[model samples]
Target: MSEAAFETEPVPDRERFEDASHVLHGPAGSAAWRQVLYALYVVALLSGLYGFTVTRAVVERYGQSWRAAGAVLPVAAGGAVLVVVLLVLAHLAGRRRGPVTPDPAWVDLVVASSVDRWLTLRESWLLPGLTLLVAGGLLGGVGGAALVGGGATGPVALPVGLGGGLLVGGALALSWLSGQVRADPSGPSRRGIGASLGSALRMRTALRGLGVDGLRAHSLRAARIGGATFTADTRSLRLEVAAPVSRGRRWRLHPGGRVRTLLRRDLLGLRRQPLLPVGGALLVLPGALAAGWVVAGDAPALVAVLGVFGLQLGAGLVAEGLRQHGDALGAPRLLGGSVRGQALAHSGAPALLLLLLGAPVAAVSAGALAGPVAAGAAVIAVLGIGAVVLAGLWLAAFRGQPPMGAFGPNGGPTTLLLWWAWPRVLSVAVGALVLVRLARLGAGEAGIGSVVLVALLLGVLLPVADSALTRAAAAHRG
Candidate 1:
């Protein structure tokens, strides 16, 4: 089933990509078995958790530690049952492996086609989206249940469930749609292993200048026909196939004329970043203010919120400066460079300064603090915070390797903790200052030099100390 001639022709028709995606193409029996196993596994796992919790709590409440085994008899039995069910599942999956049952060749062909179709993601969008919708609905239900469990009226908000479902569902649907759009029209046909081998050999000749002595790519399924994979070779070279997915000129959309640059990238990836990784992150100005309200309360919360906005302004500046600085340094060698661009490049210092100045402006507006009195203090605090960020980045950049490995002899989790913890520590310090300031200023409180003076002293002290030590260390080495 070689696809050589199949691809040249256009498709005569396609059931809307959605129909193709959602519909089943596999043989009925295996499909049915997968459905049953999935359902059983999910039920067994969740029920197991509930049963364990109930039985344990009952045993503990009875005030008999040794005799509690008898009290949790039901839990023990349930656990045993779950183990048996899991074993049965493992056996079935094992059976799905090795040997083609009905005419080895036919079995091979069926398995190969099914596996390849999924791997390549060349199918209809509707199928995947429906699958995701059902999955998202179940997940949302669980989340809503938890929210309700916390004594809130979670069940009353149907919109939350529906919105969660659509957001997750629409995303999956769009992903499926994209696959369909990219899928080669003559996708179903197969090709010879010998030709695959030849292609591998040619690629080797081009890249490594080595003849392809042998190549092996584990297909993960014994396909009878219509799909194949070319894998492993002695050439360890990564062979990265890079190409531009986007192109643009930097332009700020912010009021300050600062282009967001590559801030969000594309529409799809608008909010896709692992910034804080685990959890507990604030997005932008609004989020910053909301978080302040929660943690700092009214008046000071307003100031804290403003301070966070300043941090964002600073971070954005640093980020933009890094980009332009790299460009100006002739990185990637894009040239016929502009003098105007260099003169007014996005610089980190300015962003940091704006944030520093803005924080006091935001807080002093309450008239609790005298504005003209504390200008120096606000500038000082900004400088200290900025220095912390710059120093942290510089250290990490210098280290330039994972915590623990051959190159990083002082590596491992310990190194990671020491090296990467700086940014977080700085954030905490800044957050604490804002939080404390708010507590001191209640709506009734008023002051001019008090807060401002403190900030100025810290600002001047930290940077001067940092520069002095850095210079000393360099001089000593030289």
Candidate 2:
């Protein structure tokens, strides 16, 4: 065929591209899925508002003192900031892996066929955009309520909410822009306003334009990917080693060398997943504040018991984090015959930290807010709560399921884990009962004989429950 004749005929790829263009303008999901997602969003928003009202009421009731409000607000704000920081760090860490580069099939069909990259990316943007909007809105609503509780009532909450939403929205938008710039430096999208933002986000220029060098360094540290440098295009990231510090001779802490090895590996694993440890620690701080608030109120013992509940919940979440890392690393396979021993070692770090850190903080908060008696009781109660947390972790680790399915496949229904992990559920129930019995004893609602009876029953019951669970697990696995 002549060149002119060939040009006149349709290219199959070009024809396909033309047809695909029609479908690219809208969402990828079906209309029904979109409607479901929208409904979920609305429900979430309503739930957030309800939670705000309840939190505000609690502050009014127990934290009526200006001093109490002052203490709580800063902690809440710090927590919000910490969450944002972790998310940003995670994003940076993901970016270091690479952007959503099109596969060979997509490249041949879309890129080669001359479709706009922006159109190709548009559908992907919708979910992320919706996520930011919902999260920012919820955060704003909570913050506004907190402000109101902190004596900024009337129209002040409106401004605070708007400001918070804008701040969060802007931050997320900038991060998204940065990611885009990194993804395709030469795309048409970078020619206008995007160029400036992208250049600012680029690590080399970040120091000059936005002074994000420190933030980038912190992100690297938090991501546990130190000695790596991220470029404008994070895919082209390079590793740069700093001067090595001398390995100082360290004493072997654990009794057995085998035990030491297991502990060391588990510790390294925890360090590698800094988000869980850092975020969990930050989360527990609010419990301390809650204990303080409740202990200051009318029903000191009852309210303090409730405060211990908060601590238990926080501890449970921390345990979940540890469980997640354990599951991810397959600690079961790593330890083999010593599964029980290794599980304890893997779980030891968080439990020990909870005891060491949580006990003192809970005691101090109770002492400061209530008195010496409450403080002493808080110390005892926190000790038990910590032990319960460890028991929960032990149950989860050995059972080969997370206490809350923390490391389950992303977006997979955890209802399945909940249903399957009956023993873990039972374990948690037992722990809660023990805690309740202890709290009752402190509050004079139960006798010491009853408390000892419950404790002994727990000791006897858990072993039998664990044996049954083990048999069931082995049978299921087989």
Off by over 4 Å in 1: 1-143, 154-283, 291-296, 299-320, 323-399, 405-422, 425-429, 442-478
Which tens-of-lDDT digit does each residue in 48-134 have in candidate 2?
Answer: 677677766665665555444465466568668766764465345323422223333444555444444444434333444456666
**What's model 2's lDDT at 470?**
61
Model 1 per-residue lDDT tens digits across residues 10-31: 4422332233334434333225
Q: Could you tell me the lDDT of residue 154 within candidate 2? A: 66
How far is each candidate from the true structure, as Cα RMSD in Å?
A: 17.9, 9.8
What is the Cα-based lDDT of residue 477 in candidate 2?
Answer: 54
> Cα deviation in Å at residue 100, candidate 2?
6.1
Best model per lDDT: 2
Cα-based lDDT for every prediction? 0.35, 0.51
